[model samples]
Target: MQLVVGRIGRAHGIRGDVFVEVRTDEPELRLGPGAVLLTDPAATGPLTVESGKVHSGKLLIRFAGIKDRTAAEALRNTMLIAEVDPDERPEDEDEYYDHQLIGLDVVLTDGTPVGELTEVVHLPYQDLLTVKRPDGSEALVPFVSELVPEIDLENQRCVIDPPPGLIDLAEAELDGGPEQDR
Candidate 1:
């Protein structure tokens, strides 16, 4: 399996080092030094990580053959992909890869069918599950333990405990409810 590990951000300095917006949970392993990453456009390259470091809480990495600011700047917004084993699981049982959660059935804690998990949105602060409802509408459910108490991967279903109007709010936003008036 190929997983997106990070996106190249602007050049960090005059050197070839560029900031990386990490996407994977195992950045230390996936984006570590000497690791080679494939590019999205497929022409930029299978760049090899020559060096990496954290500065000002941001990850900065330098790739082999990319020795100047111009070279690094050209890689901005390019996605970095890594090959992963299909059977490989996270070290922590509670943590799940985005691919693992994408196809599960979504339902309320009471067993009421809600939707199908279509995507996992990774934000800097939190993650969200994009659920495609039976009615063909979509809702963004926060991927927090309190709201999503159980992920029954064995059964291929996830149980959610949404607060009042949590799912409705997403629908309303799409349909222009009273919240839109204010």
Candidate 2:
């Protein structure tokens, strides 16, 4: 199984080093030096990690033979994929891959059906679970443990304990209190 490890961002410097958005929870293991990763477009073939460092909380990576800013910039938005074992599991029991939760049904804490897990959005600060509602709408639920306290993978379900306005922003806005203005 191939998993996306990182996505190339803008060029960092003139020396071919480019910033990357780390996708995998195990960046140190997946984005380490000497790791060979396949590309999405395949136009650049495989890429070998020559060096990597964190700058201002962002990860910067340099690929072997990429010697200029133009070369690095050209690879922007490219996804770096790595092969994983079929039976691989995260070292931390609480940690889960996006694939594991993608197809699960999302319900409220009281078991009210909300949506189906469509995708996992990995942001710099936090992760979000994109859900497809029955009404053909979409919702991005932050994957915080407090709001999402349960992940019953055995039953293929996720329980969401949404805060006020988290799920039904329109309803919350419509039922505005005295503190809210028109």
Candidate maximizing lDDT: 1
Model 1 score (lDDT): 0.91
Give RMSD to native, each candidate: 4.4, 3.8
Global CA lDDT computed for model 2: 0.89
Q: For model 1, where is the 10-residue window of minimal lDDT?
A: 169-178
Q: Model 1, which residues run further than 4 Å from truth?
A: 13-15, 168-182
Clashing residue pair totals per candidate (backbone < 3 A): 0, 0
User: TM-scores for all candidates?
Assistant: 0.82, 0.72
The residue-by-residue lDDT of candidate 2 on 1-182, one tens digit each, is 88988899999879999999887889998999999999988897599999999998899999999999999999999999998874577898888877788899999988999999999988879999998999988988899999899998889999999877777877667778444974
Query: Which regions of candidate 2 are displaced past 4 Å?
Result: 9-19, 54-77, 168-182
- TM-score, structure 2 vs. true: 0.72
